[model samples]
Structure formats: structure tokens, C-alpha cells
Target: MNQKLKKQDWTVRVLQELERQYSPSRWSHRMSADDVIKAHVKALKEGTEQARDLAQTLLNVPYGEGDGEKLDVYIPKTNSLDVHLVVYLHGGYWQFLSKEESGFMAVPLIDKGVVVVAVGYDIAPKGNMDLMVSQVRRSVVSVVQQYSHISGLYLCGHSAGAHLAAMVLSTDWSQYSITPQIKGAFLVSGIYDLLPILSTYVMEPLKMTEEVAVRNSPSKLVPQLKLSSSSCQIVVAVAENDSPEFRKQSEEYYKALEESGLSVTMEDVANTDHFNIIEQLVDGEYHLTKVHR
Candidate 1:
């Protein structure tokens, strides 16, 4: 076979393998995948509703001029000088969820005087991968600028959201006016490399090409990451029951960060799948939630 045909053949085989490995719902050990997702969404909605009632929320605050470039900010009831802000990115394969269901994790954090910002970005079918990544990066910059008085800035994301958070960490902040002082990051069940996604149905709506995937892949962008905050801590956590590919990506990404001399750790949360792994963030006592605090 010619070079071009050989490459195409390899791509076909990789895609077939990824299709099985990347399908989280298929590997779910809990209830049916659909039921698990439904329960997860319900939890997110209820938790966010409770968070709104508990905190002084600033809803739909625009970070950029675009309609989807808005975020929901949850502020603690008691004002303190030592405020920590956490920017959360929701994951629905970069297409499904929205900020409306993103603030669930704030319920526990807010009571402890942590400000949580649930970011809104244009998801797939409407927004491309590049645009989503840019929006997330810009949202963090906007949050940092808006809350300049904040003592610490942190980041958290689930699945696709985690991917975006990683991208934000690997950002070339020189393009922006201010570089955010990110203190810590929590990445849960995320996809670090996008090449495998190209062959999966998940990429159908996002329409990412090989070059686009390569450019946005955090696993590939570790060299460009500006680790200005030597103390910045990155926790790459994977669900116990997550698909093999998901765990592989988190492990690989953690290794890459460790090799780069960045402060990073890997967490294998026990007895959890992709959906519940993040849904548990609503619980204050959850292992990952405790780490967030």
C-alpha cells in the first residue's frame, strides 16, 4: 500500500478500537447508561437549585459579547477577604450540558466561602472545537480580571469540561492581557487526546479535523503550558468504572504533567463511573470534593 493508503488503513483500525473504548455508557456498571445519565442530570439540576438558594448568585453574567459566553457565579453568604474562586466547566461531550446544570458542585464549596463560577460555552453542532476551547480560555481570563481581589483562582471540569480545563492550563497567556494566577485544578474523567475521538460518533457534531484535534489536545500541548505558578496543583482523577480509554487518557496526561516537572497527581476514585464520578462533587465529603477544598 502507498503511504496515504497505509495511513488511512491505520486510521480505520484505530477508530474501530476507540469506538469501543471511548463509549462510557457501554462500560457503565451501574444502572442502564441512559438511567445513569438521567439521574446525573437530575442531581445536577437539584444541586444547582439548592446552591442558588444557599449562595448570592450572579446568574448569566456575560464574559464575552457572544450569547453563549456567559457564566453563573455563586458567591458565599459571608464575605471574606481571603476568597477563592473556582471556574467550573461542564462536560456533555462538549455538546450536551450547559451552565444551567453546571453549578451543582458549588453547593458544598459555597458554604465554605469558595466562589464558584460555572462557565457557559457554545457546544457542538453550533460551536466547533476550536471555538469552545477559545471561549473557555477567555472565560478564565475574564473571571480573573473580574475578581482581581480573589486570593486564589482554581479550575474544575468533568469529562469534556476537564478537557477544556486542561486546555486552559496549557494556554499561551501572552495573547491575553492578563495571565490568571491559577492555584489548583481538578480534572475528572477527561479526554486529553482528541485524535481517537475523530473516529467516534462523538466527533460527528464537533466536526474536528486531524490538525484541529492535534492543536487542541492537551496531552500534546503540555510543552506550551505556562506553569508560572510553581505551586499550582493539578489533580487528574479518573472514575473506577470509567471506560478503559478514559482511564488511559487520565493516566497518560498525569504522566506527561509529572514528566514536565509540573505539580500533578493522579486519583483513581473507587466504585464510580464517569457520570457519578462528577455528580459526587455535590457531596461535601466525597474524596474528590474534599480535595477541591
Candidate 2:
């Protein structure tokens, strides 16, 4: 075979491997996909309840004109103009989940006197990729604008939310007439590239085309140095038991950021699966939680 043909063959094999790797059936252990989902839902429910009980929360605050353009704000007792704001985007593969399911991680941050905003965006099948990205960007802008005295803004997201959070990093803030004072970013178990996703079962509801996939991929859209904040720190983390693709995505993204001369760190949360990785944020002593401090 010619060199070009060998390259093509290699690409085909890699694509096939990605499809197999993304299949939940191949990765899910003792629990089936349905079982994992049920557990996630239950955790979110409990977390939401705990958050409401622990913090002074303002629920369903409108950030944009759309129905899904809403967020839940958890304010700590020490909230002031000088306090930092941690904005979290919940992940449901851009198809499911909501801001309400995000508060479980707020308790620890809130206890440390940080404000937490759980952002909501329109989901897929009904909400296209463009709309979802726009909503997330708008939500961040809304939080920054509303809290004029905020000291620093920290962006954090889990799974699909991490992808959206990364999108915010690449944004041209000049268009919005607001330069966000981004202090740091924590992206947990995110999909940095969308190419592999095209071959995954999750693509059905996402309705992703090659163009759309390329357009929205964060790894593909590196932040322009002039637009990127110099002081902003970044961390990309993956769970120990996360699929090989998930771990590879985080590693690749971290490498991309570092090669671009950005201050970025890569973390492997020990002994965790996809679901519990974000759940571990509730523990202040965890390495993932300590990164915020």
C-alpha cells in the first residue's frame, strides 16, 4: 500500500476504535447504562436538596430570553463585591440534564465563601449546538454583568458542560463589550474534540454534522493570544475509570493548551468513574477540590 493509503487505513481504524470506546456498554462495569444513569439522577436529586438546605439560593433566574436560558445561584453567607464567583455548567452530553442537577458541588465552594452559579442551556434535538453554546456564553455574561463587584470569575464544568466552558475561553469577548475577569478554569471529563462523537450513539440527539462538529470543538478552536487572559489558569481533569477516549481527550486538550503557552494542568482523579469524578468536588480535601484553593 502507498503512504497515503496507509494513512487512510490508520484513520479508519482509529475512528472505529473511538466508536467502540464511546459505547457505554463497553465501559460500564457491574452497572448497566440504565443503572449508571439512575444513580446519576439520584445523586443530582440529593445534591440539589443538600444545596438548597445549605445555601441561600436564588432559583431559576433568567439569564436570556429563551426558556432554557436560566440559572440557579447559590450565594454564600460572606458574599460581597470582593468574593469570587464559580460558574458551573452541568453536563448531559448537550442533550439532557439541567442547572438544578448541578448544585451538589456548590456546598464545599459556598462554605469557603465563593458564589456558585449553575447555568442552564437549551438541550439538543430541539436545541442545536450553536444555540447551546450561545446560551452558555450568555449565561456567563449575565452572571458577570449582574455581579458588578465580583473579584474573579472561575469557570468549571463536567462532561458536556466542560466542553461549553472551554468554548467560553475561546470566545471573542469584545463582541459582548465585556471582558470577563477570568481567574481560572476547571474542565472535568470533557470532550475536547467532536470528531469521535460523530460516530457515537449520542450523536443521534446532537444532530451534529462535520461542519458543526468542527466549528464547536474547543481543541480545534484554540484561544487567540490577544483574546485570552494572561492571568487565567486552567486545569483539565479525567476520572481514573473514565473511558480511554475521555482520558485521551483531556490529555490532548491539556497538551494543546500548554503548547499554546497557556498555564494548564492535567489531573487524573484516582479511583473514580465518570459520575463520581464531579461528585468528589463536595470533599474539600480532595485534590480536585484543593485545586480551587
Candidate 3:
């Protein structure tokens, strides 16, 4: 079978998994998109003190900020080293969390002696997914411009953040000339392909137009061009205990990247969950050790 054809088949499978598409009411529990968003916003408002403290530290690190969107840069005060600037994009499933919940990201990256940047953006409903990516790219480009010593940059995100990281890097960077210094990217348990979400109307606040969903998918984007092995490091790491749907999504995404002739790597984190996987991400070693290795 053709690789591209196989990908098309994979997309169909994702569509089948989406509840609203196959059956709307029961899946959504008769909740509207607004209802879902409100519930999430309420929970996030009660944030942890640890996250807030870490954000303050990150705000102090010196890195250029872009006016178009809000972001926090965490450059180790120590000075230049052959270090990777690891950018952490927070995931709220394209709706919820801020860079603060993932504050622990800065400590590990800095401990590894890498520069870290945690970007914040207006949540969806006010800004769509495209807007999210645009702001994230702006933040990344801003960092790249000021930090000439960013030996290699790594984009890492969780959940929805994972999706943004993947979408942002899937592009041909030279076209934008945003960074001549990108090393690679690590997308930990990302929803790189949105066919699943598209099957339901729940993602509409993302302003996920049909065209955007198709165009933004990493699996869909890789087939159209030739990318260099050195241009970027691509890794998709998913926890062993994620839902079968997510597991398949992870497999489908990595397989698409590989089949399309992209240099990619996949890791299944042992004994982890959708929420607990990050516990092991900062370890500096693991099955996907090459991410920091």
C-alpha cells in the first residue's frame, strides 16, 4: 500500500473515534463548547503556589519579549555555554493551562545547563489554535534572535502544548528564516493530527476550520516536501497508560513522519500516565535519552 494512502486510512480511523461525529449527545453529555471551557477555566483559576513562584523566577531571566503576545524567558544567568534553548509550550488541550503549571520545566532544563523559555498566550475562545501557534512562533523567533548562542533549540510541549510544538516545527523554517539555529524538537504525547478532534464539534472554539485541521496535521504536512536529517530532531514520547485512542494517535503520527521519509524517533514511556509522564521527563535519562543525550 502507498504511504500516503496509508495515512489517509489512518485519518479515517481517527474520525471514527471522535464521539460527536459518530454520536454527538452522549459523548459531549449535552454540553456546549462554552460549558467545557468554563469548567476548565474554573479549575485553572485555583493554581498552585509552586507554579506561581516558578513563574516569577522565569520572568526574571533575561530574554527578549515579543509585544504581540505574552511570554516568559528563562535564560540561565550563568552566561553562554554550548546549550540548547528548550522552549516549553503549555498544553490545556488548546484551551486550559498556562506556562506556570509546567514551571518545573525550567529547573530541569537549566540544571541540564540549557536555556528555557516558557510562552504564555490568551486561551482559546478569545484566540484560536492558529493564533496560538502564531504567538508561539513569535515567541520562539524572538528568543532565537536575541540568543545567538542558542547552540541548538528544542521545542517540547505536553498534551495540547505538544500539538503546538509539533505544528510549529513541521514548517520549513528557512522559508521564514526565523532560526538558522534549530536543533530539533521533542513532542511528548502530542495530538499532532487533529482528525480526532475534527470528528467532534468540541474543538470549534479552537476555530479549527477544516482546512486548518488538514494543513496543520504533522502527518499531513510531511509528505509534501524533503527535510534534512540535521535540520531538526523529531521525537514523540507517549506514556504506556494513555488511552488506546491516544496510543494509536501517537503511533499514527510517528509512523506518518517516518513513512514520509522524515528522520524521527518514538518512545513509549514505561508505567506512566497521561498526567504523570512528566515526572520522568526531567530525569536526564530514559528510553528516549537522546532527547537530552
Please, what is the TM-score per model?
0.94, 0.91, 0.74
lDDT of each: 0.90, 0.85, 0.63
Q: Residue-wise lDDT of candidate 1 within 1-293, one digit each (tens)? A: 59999999998898788887887877778888788888888989999998998999999999999999999999998757779999999999988989999889989998799999999999989999999999999999999888878998999999999999999988888899998888899999999999978878998898899999999999998877745545679999999999888999999999989998999999999999999898888899999999888
Can you write out model 2's per-residue Cα lDDT over 40-130, one digit (the tens) per residue? 8788878777888999999999998888899999999873559888999998889888887898878788778888999989898889998
Query: Which of candidates 1 and 2 reaches a greater lDDT?
Result: 1
Error of 2 at 272 (Å): 0.5
Rank the candidate models, highest TM-score first.
1, 2, 3
Judging by TM-score against the true structure, name the best candidate.
1
Query: lDDT: which candidate is best?
Result: 1
Q: Considering lDDT, which of the candidate structures 1 and 3 is the better prediction for this target?
A: 1
Pairs with backbone N, CA or C atoms under 3 Å apart (clashes), candidate 1: none
In angstroms, how far off is 140's CA in candidate 1? 0.8
Clashes of 1: 0
Supply candidate 2's per-residue lDDT for 189: 90
